[model samples]
Target: MSTYTVTSFASASPAFTETTYEVPRELPAFHVFVDILACGVCYTDLYRFDAVPGSICGHETVGTIKDVGPNVNHLKIGDIVGFGYLRSSCLDCHQCTSGCDIMCKERKLFSHGPGGFAHAVVWDSRFVYKIPSSLEPKYAAPLMCAGATVFAALYNNNVSPTARIGVIGIGGLGHLALQFCRAWGCQVVALSGSLSKKNEALSFGAHEFLNTKELTTETVKAQPKFDFILNTTTGDLPWDLYLSLLNPNGILCLVGFQEKPLEMKSNHFLYHQARVVGFLVASRGVSKKMLEFAARHNIKPMIEEYPMTAKGAANAMQNVRDGKVRYRAVLIVPQDSSKL
Candidate 1:
């Protein structure tokens, strides 16, 4: 048996608790032995905690491969691997076959099994990815989820080098989206409700910053109509205002999941032939593409590291849920585990 740290949901008042779990000596299909070095807590993890009780919730993972099952030939012991929110999918599905496992009918998410928050994650090799030695594991964790999602959205939407892109909100997903957009050669505009984020947004590579509360149609008219807008805020946006900011055939893609339904004007879309699209992460096929793109551009998430054993781990989850983390929060497993 192996003892590991695990976060689980309680049936009563205390929703989340840290506990020790023992794993039997049997192996699951396609399971890889991963000594988790870092695990990034995402907003999605909070959603899982709220929606599913007793779930192991984390997705952004970075670790060293300790073992690979019999059928797994691509990965070996001592290989550095990373995984995003998705754990498994049915390859025979239409969405999976079309290079869109994000839309797979039987997609298995991280909450369904042993997630990144644990000391070791026994995951399917198909969901595992090799990481470069040059990139730090803590910094690379969020890219597996946040970076990959935004990168895939931008690339899948055909964002051009000359495209004017707007990244809404300066939180976790938005921060990384800003960097990806700027590095993609697109003119990036940071749109947020607070003026305080202006300087920080500029530091993250935004060419211009707009306070959405102070925004007017004149301000929208002054700048070039956006080719695309990446709405990364956890809440709903004023859809009419966002749609009006777009040019003909301009697209506004949403990556965040808001609690309530969003309202919008249908006439706005019809007038400009604009689109409001939503994308999750990428397929197993395109994840490599996303990582390679980040590797080439040096795009990575700004992460704050915490220890897995620290009392702050639970607080970090609440911080992410409350929108207090500067960008990303990663839980660092004990360094000695790296040798196990």
Candidate 2:
């Protein structure tokens, strides 16, 4: 095994730098070292750097396993795999045993544990998933996190192909949700704050594009109510407007967390029997199912790739923070074979 390894970190308040770190020559049971091919940069990574120092950040990663432990049978060396936000979960927990490992009380994020920013990482084999042969590694990385999260949220809500789905926030998550909803035979509406996203939304299979700023209770009431509205924004909406857009028994799923509380008129919900729910990245079980579903449907993220070197981390992080990334930013690590 090679003794040299590389890692990226927040060099200053908001900056990152690449530096070499040490690599273990062997593996322990339930552990495997993977040579990372791509690491996706998401908004949550920024939240970690807000008050801390020297935090290793990155969870969405796709790569090849270099070594495996004797106890691990489901995976083997040289297998192309991907791991999401979590690295460890207590198997005995209700959530884990029930296939909801994302909610396990003992869940530990790789960012908070040993993350995927390094050239090689030691991960629990149970948390790693083999990539579908049909998907490219670079595009598959973000799907492990963003893609899985949205897919799980919809699945958890029991969204059917006949459901009328509206996706709010046309950024990374919204784009993927639009495609998934469309592929499932649902009529999708892209709800955005800017008029600029109208064309982009339509191109992504949204049957309708409505500017949130221009929408009001009366205006929305005139249109057919959506069976489900997936809110992926960082701020609260005029809840009355969203609640009004729902048909009887419709749901509003909050996938994005805002700093402020959402304001709503209780009467609107009480009269319509509307419900509000929230979700995060799914458990390992759901992630696996989502991947299988995606593979069958040919649903994939629109990715912008970068190298795993210092320069690549900087460019991708900046694009993510500025919301300039087209959809998702995936960092590619040159394989050792590439160096040859």
Best by TM-score: 2
Query: Model 2: how far is 193 from its true place, Å?
Result: 2.4
Note the clash tally of each candidate: 0, 0
What are the lDDT scores of the predictions, listed in order? 0.80, 0.82
Best by lDDT: 2
Report lDDT (Cα) of residue 73, candidate 2.
Answer: 95
Each model's TM-score, in the order given? Answer: 0.92, 0.94
Q: Across residues 1-340, which tens digit of lDDT does each residue of candidate 1 receive? A: 6643333223111245555555533556677878888889888877776776656667899988876777888888899999988889897888888888878889997767767776776888988889876678898899888888898899888889999999998988888898888888999999998788889899999999988997776666776678899998777667888888998999989988877888988886788899989888877767888787778878788878777753656767778767778899998887764333
Worst 10 residues of 1 by lDDT: 5-14
Displacement of residue 78 (Cα, Å) in model 2 is 1.2
- Candidate 2 stretches with Cα past 4 Å from truth are 1-6, 9-11, 336-340
